[model samples]
Target: MIQLWTPEITTLLTRFFKANHLPYGQDFPGHIPTGRFSNGKLNPDFVASFLGIKQTVPTSLDPNLSNDAFNGLVFASAGSGYDELTTILTGAIPVPKQLGQFKSYIAKLSRIFGNNEAQNIIEKSLAIISAGTNDFGFNYYLLPMRIQQFDINGFQDFLLKALHDFVKELYKRGCRKIVIAGLPPMGCVPILVRKDSSRPSIEHVWRTRMLMPVLQWKARFTETEEGCCGSGLLEASFLCNPETPVCETPSDFMFWDKLSSKRAAYKAMSHLLVNQILPKLTLE
Candidate 1:
């Protein structure tokens, strides 16, 4: 299974008020390390549990963690993105580096399981990708401020190209089933709402401006932001301020935070996968 370029660990750690921010540390290994971007489990772990697979494999650091965990492996970093430039924010392992790690893992599997078994392993794998939010949230919206270079469309195009390339690489690596998630509404994230609000606006301009672009792009992907449990702009506000009153039901919302989705969002994503993408892939 693939769980690439997500901060599931980091978000959970921050939820407990930990300030150290372990997920972004560059020294953290990519494949089977114990120091996953958080204090506890990551989204992959939960996903593994749901699949009835062994808990997600670590980044290649923990000697105890084995390659046989999920009948494959996971090569995700807390804040990495599909693009190289986007990985700079958290100093996490970029997708290229993770691909290299996958190569090494494949080599070891080949040595132990023989060529046919290894090939079978590679062919039947499911790749789960959750990225792009960092590209907008940290790179375009936060850091140098991409609004200066291009409008939302240009930036979305750039991100989609990166994703396209990443998917192509996976196809080269013998993966046919690809599950890619679109960006959640990031504007209402507490980080953006609180930060952008400091700027001038008419009617929650900070939130509306930040979210609309992402929402537009959501329609481009098979799994849309609409009716997602935890990923909409409205939902993000509620999640970031759990104590505050904004939206009553989070199931229809899209964003879980600035960078992720609620359980419902994943369900929507999965529905698209099982119903739309999987059939096409099977035909391929």
Candidate 2:
């Protein structure tokens, strides 16, 4: 009897702009443009490469695209959050909607590969869910609804529960291996650090609430004061154009835009994931 092992996995990155490929940053041309928030490769890009899978995971939102489960897919949106209201307010795809897209992708895969093969792939695929920061950055801090309803701790609990449900749903859909990324050092993000020194530090709060081990990349960044692109205040995507003044040494900068980290930072993060995180996931 031939012993079957767990199938190779597909992972999802949740949250806004985390997977946006708009305006096509680098490497990805018009033929395979993405809406990623960063100036170059995000953490997921490196994670995919480290897993020995195809590096460019196509965004599921593209209308002209077809299912390519072997290469993986990115369902995240910039400005999106775990909360439905958050996506509605920011005009980004909500977490639930991203999952819905995954469901649709699975259906298409079933049509092409048959039910059993699709189910095996789904069972083996890794689901990477990155969220929460936007709920704090865009909603609780910038908006008023969540603040009016709950204090910082209360809101954190709400988001944690939402995350819990998201993972639970993925498990229900046959995704056995799920990786939920904890929030980065949001306080250290150039835009926030430059804008508000008085802002209370929530890094500890996020770490504590999530109960997941955090990846540290602070030591790798020398330019923590501002982003490499333009003023680094709020510039991103189209706002960060070719005409925008960039730093002479982008590798030194922690961020490429107001919200997204530079390639160097993400590269460090990818190494951490490959060395520390991926080993436990039992990837082939």
Candidate 3:
């Protein structure tokens, strides 16, 4: 019943607040929030509202909450992922570390409520995860560590396996409802698009092609300008060009930045969460 990345819900939050603000941080005054990247609301805030729960307690906030107050919280960090490398790669908090924080959350909840109640809360609550683009960008493209250890396919498999294990740990600890996000077309981020504008304007090359989903969501953008084809190359070129002029309507595009996806990309993620992961939670 929890909705995380729905634009419809986000729009509502914007209207209700009567302020054009995103939950994520902005650099400009009155623009950037402390940590969030968006102008007003991030996916988690919107999702918490949609679930009718107050926004979940951030992991960092876990140390300060009363036990009773902790039971209803949802734990989600924007720039985190399953692999330690993703955060180290992105220079953001990694997934395993976040799980460590979750341990504290569980402990806090147990204190306010009895062990049974804490377990019950976690069992029913949903955990949503979205990460991995940074690993490719910050680690692979930027260095030789993971890339030296594994090829593109190998790296992809490694991260997914990491996810499998992370979710399994959550499940073992009482987290039953969980959602995992597949990679979107990251090649079109305004920054990467800009990067591609340099000397290497290659089509469907490993640099860009590797970023698209390997197995899931394969056919969706396969033919579009963002897909692995001649036109896709041209699109990346135009979009990446510093002189190409950035579009205000980022939702119309796929990639938001070199490391994140736009609204459309998140929309695809929402579908997988609802249609695929949600139904499977009870199966756990």
TM-score (C-alpha, index-matched) for candidate 2: 0.81
lDDT of the structure predicted as candidate 2:
0.64
For all predicted structures, in order, the TM-scores are 0.61, 0.81, 0.62
Q: Mark the regions of model 2 whose C-alpha exceeds 4 Å error after superposition.
A: 1-33, 64-67, 198-220
User: Which residue window of length 10 is worst by lDDT in model 2?
Assistant: 1-10
Compose the digit string of candidate 2's lDDT tens values, residues 1-284. Answer: 00011111112333323334332255343433345556566666667777777665556655556544455777766667787777645667678887887788778778988999888888878777777777887788877898999999999899989988887878887788777777766776666766765656675355233422322454355565577777645676556655677778766766777667766666676677678876887653
**TM-score of predicted model 1?**
0.61
Q: Rate the local accuracy (lDDT) of all candidates.
A: 0.53, 0.64, 0.49
Comparison by lDDT, 2 against 3, better one: 2
For model 3, residues 1-284, the per-residue Cα lDDT tens digits are 22212111111121211112332223224554333333234455545544455543233433464543443443444444555665453344466866776787678678878899879877777766666766676576777688789999998899889978877888888876767666655655545554555645565365456545521452243322232211233222123223333445443444433333343444454444446555655732
Error of 3 at 89 (Å): 5.2
**Candidate 3 wrongly placed segments (more than 4 Å):** 1-32, 55-59, 62-79, 197-284
- In candidate 1, how many Å is residue 185 off? 1.0
lDDT of 3 at 39: 29
